[model samples]
Target chain A: MAHVVGPEVVKYACTCGLLKSISSLYFCRYCCQLRCGFCVCHEVDSHFCGKCCENLPSSEARLKKNRCGNCYICPSCQQELSTRIGSKGPSNPEDPKSTPKKMYYLSCLYCRWSSRDVGIPDQSAATGGWPDRENVNANRLQEIIEMYKAMVLAEKQQKEKDKKKQRGKYLSYTDRTGVTAAALRKRIGLPVDIQHSLLKAKPKEPEPAIAKEDVEDLPEELLTKPVNLTEVTTIEQRLLQIDLQPTTVEKLFPVHKQLSIKRSLRCRSCEHNVSKPEYNPNSVKFKIQLFAYYHVPEIRIVTVEPLRAGRPSELIIKFTNPTQHQTTITILSLVLSGDENEVKEETGDQPSLPQEKQPPSLSSQPSSLLSLSSRQPSITIKPRPVSQEVNADVAIPSSKVILPPRDDAAEYDDSGDTHNIQDDPKLVVWRKSNKAFVKLLVTPKQGLALNTEIVAGFTMQHIYTNTIATTVENREPDKHDHNIRVFLTLGNLVGFD
Target chain B: MSRNSIKILQGALVCEESKLRGDITIGTGTIIHPSATILAEAGPIIIGDCCLIEEQVKIIHRLPFDQQDKENTPVLIIGSHNVFEVDCHVEAPKIGNYNVFESKSFVGNKVTVTNGCIIGAGCKVTQEQILKENVIIYGHDCHMREGLDRPGLQTLQMETLSKMLPNYHHIRKPNKKN
Candidate 1:
């Protein structure tokens, strides 16, 4: 019988194949390979002070003359020098604070000798905390200003050139350009000298207008024929009553796209990079920084339905999760406001009907496997007030559910999978708790029609209570009455109906 | 705007040939000039309120930086009663009053000179550097660069002055005029 043995399989072909933990793998800086410390050449960059790294913001770091403002490069070995607290060790004993307490890796690019071997002291190491440079000279300062001025002048000249080029493209649109030029000059408050140059009369050009037949003609069906939306209208009519049911009105349209990670390589000499290198392919063990927008699942319902009897109506929302995973949800109070509807309905307004979407049914598994949990964990959240007004849609996952993976998905273990979809249909159940009463009364006028023209738009929880006079003769019952209540489910909510 | 006028874009004052009051201290290297008005109505113009203002050489506080947006308005605080000599300009300080300005001083944009400090003649303070209270500055444009590349050559002259006047301290008293 032919031996069915695989050709001499390597036992420890990359610790990746072995049963070893991730920590055992050593990162190689130069080769960008992950070895078990035995496979590849490991080179260390400059050692930086831990304290400085923690304190400095990224913006400030980029502005520094050196790539690192606090950490210094070792002039002798080209290796990073480690900073140590207290006097003693390889630093000046006279200056007690200048010493290396811990051993950090450094590489000599020329010799390929790591800091582990040659004990050469790096000059870039912070021996005395901070260095004092001499004061700036007045002449150099003036030169910097002059250079900045020249750069600004060059930028202005380039903008002018671009404007002239744009003008060349549409020479026949001289009248429009004249108007735009006048408007721009007025808006920017340009002085008289520039205005004179701008408003100078130029020769006008007349161009032949294209006939209707010259333009690209569309199909007759696409042009004047109307779409037969009877099916949509009937479905919309059937669902109109369901919209009247009280529910949370928080709705948002999320433009969902895949969260992908891109890796790039950066050179120490020039802070710029040629291409993004793969993180997994590189043996460089960089500190992974993860930023996430963690939300506390909550729902809100806003309505304009006036409460005449000094009583608030209850809001009822139903959400169904199609996925088998159990999720958490929270209910939040809603803000209600009143406003007039000024949007006029177009004659051929074929209200787009929503396609019948199926609810995700739960598996036949026992309910004992899942339990209710808080949407937000009991962690203190310090609300950092943003200086500007922001319109942001935050997805608040339940404490039980997981947050979705971001672009840099490798950084975080976002195990919650349901959140990555538009309809992870959650069943949110809540009751209206506000007791604020609002009153609306319509008084008639002499010159107007017998009945006042009243229109109303409502959401899932909001009910339109517009007073209608029975005297209006030419009103269609289906069109004049409130047609539908819109149900909006936000990403942050658990269940929505 | 002209280059010189552009320099005054970020809340700078030019005394425009005026006198400054006393008891105000300014940050190091502020510039104020002639053809400026600094009238501290109520509070003294205290430079270096937040250490952001640079070069309060001959600056005065006729109006506050915030209140300068008001139309046809005269500011109440010309902090520290600070005065400027020829080519001395006055702009509003951050907060706190006390003016102490002296002759031929040129304060730059965004300069802060605190209360109880005196600025002396021909001084040109450019960038944002603090001048503490009771800090007395003397000489012309004390800020001078000390490097190999001296493009403008004016920095070299300033450096010479810095060397000539070696003794510098927060509490150093002004040397008597020769």
Candidate 2:
């Protein structure tokens, strides 16, 4: 647990070839592979305010520009402002029954900044109605937006007309013969018109802004007065009020707090959600979380002997089984990314994958499930190759360790191991209810310099007991071997004594 | 340097477990918690009224190395309504009213603190300069800003701590009468 602040000694290579801690990696039960944030598709599930926890619909969020209307942050320090109650003295000094009026003003506790500094008047009641400054350029901006909308609408109509012309099987009344429209009008005994309504219709473009050459010169007072840093607002304070980046302190205003969103991650291969958060903003639980820490055997480096080049050193690591099913763990030789062609081919160039792997036949799933959640096809990002180098060699033991099922009551039950399970004395150093410490030998390469960091890698194969009911008929859950690449970063080599 | 002379005026609550050495004067209604150290190596410290010195705070009055042989003993005078939060080290020569030295903050001997000044948590002020009134040094970048008013007083916190600390800890009696 100290590794939260200390160095990360153990890292698991994601199926996408990125090395991440097991806690950050997710296990897709349907795909039966480890997925990381890089490989998973992250989508916004809901938007909510961090302070008030008020959820906003996507349309409303877009309308409000993704900022919480009620909550404001201090422009000076970026901390949330607290509304302070100030009491004005009773209107009548002689009347004892009169209550003093309460006025509310936003104040920053950290920097002691308040709305009064910028000359904003205090409100009588708290929630809102503090005057919002109208944007000076709002009208012009609205006109420009309307002009663009009209132009785009006209373009779309022209495109549709062209499409209709292309769809026509025969020539039209004008295009078929060599007769002009003016001649046709004369033949019909009517006055010939010069312009056609459709031909003359066009959207008027707005006048473009012209570049000015003149620049304002510095004021004469700048030479005589000492520069006061306090009067001028810092870059951060100015940027907080994005629309109007005020240069002076008096122009600084409180900014509305931006909204936060919950994200749902889906696996690309099987198109199943790997992690989905609960909709409620206050609840910390997740609706569906297939984290690898719950499914895979977590490895932690316990201790390692001081390193010397070409000398064998003992390295002890602890493994914990988080699931309820007993599983067997085996250590195998590491296979680099390029060497595994089958794994690479399936994950990459999968745009037209007709037959999805791992899930019970895709046709067997309900049709409504597919139509209800149909969305635009997600773009697949290819994983990069693992770039970590292994400087040390690990002695892969032939024996396998059997981890017992996790029992909550066994924590208090002092009566130790009644179950008869065979253990390798050389490998198993210590064993608890569901945890075991395994020992191994590591040898750094001979050419390594002093103080060079040693890295050892291996592939771990564990029997994963799937608990998901894949089918109604098959009562027994499937058991399969899941392979994971484990890399350990041993400390720097001290010397070659 | 080994002399232990402490003068706690009336209404001042100075804990007996606090490490007080040399000549130190606590003003009326000032509260000093247990394990707070005030070492007067080169001079006496005069703490003013209603100041709060929390646990693990170290206020040392050691002069610079070059001025060790000077004849005059420099007096470290702290002003009223100040707050020295947990683990703050103040070696500053002068302190003014309504200033706050937040937790884990350090003030070097060269810097002078003034009224309504706040040294943010974990901020270190080692530069030699006089702090302006209401100047707040905040964040890891040590951003500076002038506040409109002094930060709210810790009257409620001090009232609760005063009532709570004596129940569990030993209090040093005030010998000096106001």
The most accurate candidate by lDDT is 2
Candidate 1: deviation at residue A369, Å? 10
What is model 2's DockQ versus the real complex? 0.52
Candidate 1 per-residue lDDT over residues A28-129, each given as its tens digit: 221111233332222222222332432222222222322454443332222344443222275465776675554334332221223323333333444333
Assess candidate 2 and give its TM-score to the true structure: 0.87
| Model 2: how far residue B149 lies from native, Å | 2.6
For candidate 1, the chain B TM-score comes to 0.36
Give model 2's TM-score for chain A to 2 decimal places.
0.84
User: What lDDT does each candidate get?
Assistant: 0.30, 0.82
TM-score of chain A of each: 0.18, 0.84
Task: Indicate the docking level reached by candidate 2.
Answer: medium
Model 1, span B1-178: residue lDDT tens: 0111111222223233423443333333223433333334433443432122223333444443565576553322333233344454544344233333445565554566555544555656645655554444443324221111111113353344334333331222222221
- Report fnat in order of the candidates: 0.00, 0.47
